[model samples]
Structures are given as C-alpha cells and as structure tokens.
Target: MNLPKIVLALGYSGLIPFFIGPVWLGFSPETAPAWLDRAWLSWAALIGAFMAGTFWGFALPAVQGPAGLLGIFISVALVALTGIAVTLEFAHALAGLALVFMLLLLADFWRERTLDTIGGYFRLRSTLTAGVLIAITWRYLMLPAGGA
Candidate 1:
C-alpha cells in the first residue's frame, strides 16, 4: 500500500530525538551532561507510551473478540512498563525502554500480519525500531565501566 507522505515523514523524523542522546554524549568533552541520560530515557519512555496508544487503536475494531481484548490488555501493560522503565536507574532504564520499543515493534508486526495488513507501515516501524535500538545501545556502551 502506498503510505501517505506525512506518515513516512513523521515516523522517520521521530527518530531524531533517539539519535540525539548518543550524538550529545559523543560530543561531550568528558562524561555526558547532567541531564543527557535522563533526557534520553524520558524521550524513549514517552515514545513507548505513545506506541501503546497506537496499539490500543489497532485493537479497537476487534474489541468484541478475545484477540482484541488481549491486544488492549497488552497495550495498557506496555504503558505501565514504560512508566516503570523511567523510574529505574540510567543503565537499567535504557535497557528497559529498549525492550519496550522492541515489544512495540513486535506488536506492530502482529498487527500488520493479522489485524490490518498494512504494507509499508511495518517496514517503517522496523526501520525506526532499529534506529532506536542502535541509539540506545550506543548510549549504553558510552556509560562508565559499571554503567552510570
């Protein structure tokens, strides 16, 4: 299916914040700035929550069925997970958010295959997810020996 230009533009541009964390850390003369880590984690957590809402929207049509209910449940659970991730220490929070994003990508994949069958959407999500994971990994590696 042909995706709207707006969707493609927004989806890819959304990744800018994800990459900003690593880029900021890389340019720092010493360690990451006081707010850099938290900023990055917060951005990730927010995105995770946003993804959960999209998942919920996808499940709306099937709300009468068990799969739809399960989908809704999982979407809510992802928001809770995202909240918990933000409360953790830096390294753990990074890992947690990464996992949440991956799960979101999986949910999108499931939706594509079973729910909507949107052609380019899942591909875009996969690419964005990779970008997010890469950024998270980059920041993780930049952490101090034992992690900050």
Candidate 2:
C-alpha cells in the first residue's frame, strides 16, 4: 500500500468540482454581478489548487511520520470546508462533492489496505462517510423547504 498513490487519487478527485463548477454555475459570468462571479471563480480555483496540493503532499517521498498525518488531515479539512461551503448555498453541489469524495476515499483504501496501520485508511474512510452522511441529510433537510 503506497501512500503516494492514495494522495494522487484524492488529488484527482478535486478536479471533479473544477469541471462541474462552471456548468453548475450556468457558465454565464454575465448573468451574475461582477463581484459574485469573481468570488465564485476564486473559490473554484482555490478548490482546484488544494486538490493539486493534496496530491503532492501525500505523494512526496520526503514526507513521513507526522508529516504524512498532516497531509491526511489537510485533505480531510479541505473536504469538510468544501462541504460547508456548498451546503450553505448549493445543497446539490454538496451532495455531488460527497459522492466524489467517497469514491476517492474508497479507491485510496483499496490501494493501501496494509497502510491501514499508518492511520490513513481509517481516518479517510471516516471522513468520507461523514461527508456522505452530511450530504444526504442536507438533501433531505432541504426537501421540506422546496429543495427540488
């Protein structure tokens, strides 16, 4: 179970949102006010950059011990932060991110079953599960409020 591969997978997962953001936002910058468009694009770029960073952070051979743990923590934190952001305005986006995150975590777990000893496997699984649960709950919670 190599740590680098797991990180790469998670990092790639970040790209999902990058591609979706434009379409989800209707890809009409003109429709939104200048400030709103700029803010949305900035946040999207931030998510993409974090995804790339997560890939390298976990992949670097020089990173070991506590540093590896830190990498995982940062990845989880990014997922949580993104979830919160999407939940606040776009519940559907939150759900989509949750699905992507869960799939990425599953792939990572499969790649490094033995590395479960290193604290990466279980922690990632738990975080992914939490994200999914939150997304599902958010979806249902919005139903009563005319989420459809």
Candidate 3:
C-alpha cells in the first residue's frame, strides 16, 4: 500500500538534521560551533530511539509468540544502545549510533518477513537509512584526524 503524503513528507523531512551536520562542517569546519558534532550525534540518538519505539509498536501484534518477544527485545536494546551512544566520546558515540541505525534497519527487515507492517514502510526505511548512513560517514570523515 502507498504511504500517506504526510507520512512521506514527515519521513523525508526527518533527514534534514542528518544532512545538516555534514553540510555545516563542510562549509566551515574550522569555525563551526564546538557543539555542532555533539548536537548532530544527539539528534541521531534521539531519532534512533524514536524508531525503536515504532519498532515496538509494529511488533506488538506478534506478542503472542517468540518473534514478537524478540522484536520487543531488539527494540528495547536499540534504545539502550542509543542512550549509551550519547554518553560516549564523540567518535565512539558516532560509531555507536551508526551501529544502532544499521541494527534497527536489520530488525525492520526481519519484522517485514516475520510480522505485519505497513506496506511501503520498509522501502522508505531502506532509503532513509541509506541517507542517514551517508550523512553519518560524511560527518565522520570531516572529524579531526584525532576525532572530535
């Protein structure tokens, strides 16, 4: 099924923050605010947590079985990972968030196979996740040689 226009709009708009970090740093790596990387990392973690919650919601109907339970467990773990990511040193935190995003996508792919989910959502997720990953890598590359 097709996603609603609003959902598409909101989903794509969510990518803006992901790009902001790289773009800002690219333009002014030397003069960018000291908190810029941290802010970007924080935003990534927040979005990751939100996505995890959505994963939990998607997995709810399957709660009667192991698949559902596993999904819920994964969701919780993702949130925890994101929380941990925010507390680490900048480079470590960026790695952690990237890992979390990858895991979340993998989980959603699993969910698509094992449970009911909104049609078109996974495709959108795949696209958005790729964009996120690119932004993350771009930002990472821009980090100082010793890391932020």
Candidate 4:
C-alpha cells in the first residue's frame, strides 16, 4: 500500500533497532556490544509508549465504549511495561512491549471511524508489530542460557 512518506519513514525507522541488534549480534557471539541489546529493548518500549500516548490522545474525544476502555487498558499496560522494561531483563521487556502493542492494536480496531484515511494505520501497525515481535522473539531464542 502507498502510505504517507512520513508514516513509512517513521515505521521503518522504528524497526532499525530491532533489525540491527540481532543481525549484528549474530556475528559477534563472543563479545557483543551493549548498545545492540539496549537498543532493541529501548526502541521496542519507546514505540509501545509512543503508540499508547497516541491512543490516549485519541480516546479523550471518544465516549465511554470499547475503544475507550481499551485505551484505559493500554495506558495501564504502558505503565507496567515501562516499569518492566527498565527493571526487568530484555526478554521480559520485549514481552511487555508486545503486550502494549497488542492492547494498542485492539483499541485501534474498536475505535470509532473519524478520518477518511484510517485503514492504512492499522496495516502499518500490523506489519510493524509482526516484524518487531519476530525480531525480538528471535533475539530471545538465539541468546545464550541467560543472555548476551
């Protein structure tokens, strides 16, 4: 699909950390850089938070309904995930990031139609989240007993 250039750029830009970390890490098994691992978790959570913030903004204008309720849930999840991402391990953080995206996507699906062009946002999210989850899960799977 032809998405706005900004959306396309931002979506792929967000995936940079997820893509770079594993691909680069896969080569340096013995002594991997700290930034790769940190970047993956940080970017994942950052995007989750960014999406949650957007949802919250949209939900305020919406009345009490499924979308609104889910927005609330997304906010709560964001807080938990943000805390988890900081205190817990990278794997745990990735899982939390996935949960935030799950809730965000759910909210988006149920949200009321307001704009003329809406479907593309969902399409972008579906692709981005799938890539993110796959990349993060692959990182978790490829890691040594504890972590890299």
For model 3, how does the per-residue alpha-carbon lDDT over 46-145 read when each residue is reduced to its tens digit? 8999999887898898888999998889999999999998899988888888999999899989988998888899999999999999999888887788
Weakest 10 consecutive residues of candidate 1 by summed lDDT: 110-119
Instruction: Find the candidate with the highest TM-score and give its number.
Output: 3
Q: At residue 95, what lDDT does model 1 achieve?
A: 88
Question: Which structure is stronger by TM-score: 2 or 4?
Answer: 4
Instruction: Tell me each candidate's TM-score.
Output: 0.93, 0.35, 0.95, 0.77
lDDT of 2 by residue, 76-122 (tens): 65556555545554545545545545544554554344223444545
Those runs of model 1 whose alpha carbons end farther than 4 Å from true positions after fitting are 30-32
Number of backbone collisions per candidate, in order? 0, 0, 0, 0
- Model 1 lDDT per residue over 1-148, tens place: 7789999999989899998888877886366677876777888888889988887888889889987887898799899999998898889989898889888988887777666556687888899899999999998898889987
Where model 4 places Cα greater than 4 Å from the true spot, the runs are: 1-3, 63-73, 112-117, 146-148
lDDT of each: 0.85, 0.48, 0.89, 0.69
TM-score of model 4 relative to the true fold? 0.77
* Model 1 C-alpha lDDT versus the unseen true structure: 0.85
Q: RMSD per prediction, one decimal?
A: 1.5, 12.5, 1.1, 3.2
The candidate that wins on lDDT is 3
lDDT of 2 at 103: 48
Q: What is candidate 4's CA lDDT for residue 3?
A: 70
- Decide which is better by TM-score, 3 or 4: 3
